[model samples]
Target: MTTNQRRAARFNKAFGNRLAGPLLSRMPGFGAVLHKGRRSGRVYRTPVKIFRTAGGFTMSLPYGPKSDWVRNVQAAGGCQLVSLGRRFDLVEPRVYHDREQRVIPRPLRPLLARFKAFDFIELRLAPAGAGRAER
Candidate 1:
């Protein structure tokens, strides 16, 4: 990440996120990624723009695929997604770069592209009674 990017990330971590997380977590087309720290074993919830795909969901890695939360999800092999105010367990995370940005809805493609976001992660919904639980 460049200096500006790193500073922006730090700013979000320290301030912006605290204000946006609660609202974003409940909004349609937006969600929260609930992942655990790979080493610290601490839990985190990050606001994200998520889109549904057949049998799964896709999230753009604007922070880049190497972001701590993304790494945590990959290392753990799964994570929980809070979408539309409901919690869903997800597994089989697949992170890859796609300039076509095909899995997500078309309208969002341009927006992500503008951010230079070509990397994304897709995860299948955990089977009912396998891991998913909603409230």
Candidate 2:
């Protein structure tokens, strides 16, 4: 991460996480990635800009991979996400640098581009129509 990225991360943790995180997490198109702490086992909800993809969903990592939520999800191999008024069990975690951010909604692309958040968290959502137990 560059100096700017580091600064932004700090600011987000200090303010954004506490203030905007909860509200955004509940809204449509924006939601929370829920993960457990690597050691403490405490659950955490992180606000993220999420977009639906062909098979699943992609999240913009504005704070890059070093963010706590990103690390937690990666370490655990899977996590739950609440978005679009539904709960999804997301698995097969992968990280990538989506330079063009093609997965993001067109209207939001420019805003995300300004933050240079090319890092993305990709996960495969459980098959639709699966029974509650399957999900």
Candidate 3:
């Protein structure tokens, strides 16, 4: 990580959780990615900037790919997305940089583009008939 990214991560860890996390996690068009710690086995809920796609949801990784939640999700191979008052069992995790920003909303694209936040974490919902649990 660059110096700026390291600093930003520190700031997010110190303030984002206490300030923005609770509010963002519950709002529409935004949700929490639920993943478990690889070693500790502790559950973590991370607030993310979410965009709906044809198949599932795409989220911006403001803290970049090195974020703990990202690693946890990748390690577990899936995670739960709590959004729209529903809990979805998301599978087939994919992380990449969408430089064209095609999946991002038009209004937010410019702002996100400023931060060069092209790294994304994508999760597709499990098939409808597959049993899943609620929040």
Instruction: Compare the candidates by TM-score and give the number of the best one.
Output: 1
RMSD of 2: 2.8
Q: How far off is residue 115 in model 2, in Å?
A: 0.6
Candidate 3 C-alpha lDDT tens digits along 29-65: 8888888999999998888888888777889987788
| Per-model TM against the reference | 0.92, 0.84, 0.89
Name the weakest run of 10 consecutive residues (lDDT summed) in model 3.
126-135
Clashing pairs in 3: none
lDDT per residue (tens digit) for residues 1-135 in model 2:
789888878888688878998788678888878899998999987778888887778899887887888889999987888765677888778999988887887888889888888889998876556422122
Candidate 1 CA-lDDT value: 0.87
lDDT of 3: 0.84
What order do candidates take by lDDT, descending? Answer: 1, 3, 2
Candidate 2 yields a Cα-based lDDT of: 0.82
lDDT of each model, Cα atoms only? 0.87, 0.82, 0.84
lDDT at position 80, candidate 3: 87
Candidate 1 on 40-113: residue-level lDDT in tens?
A: 99999888888888877889888788888889999999999998878989999999999998886788788888
Residue-level lDDT for 113 in candidate 2? 87
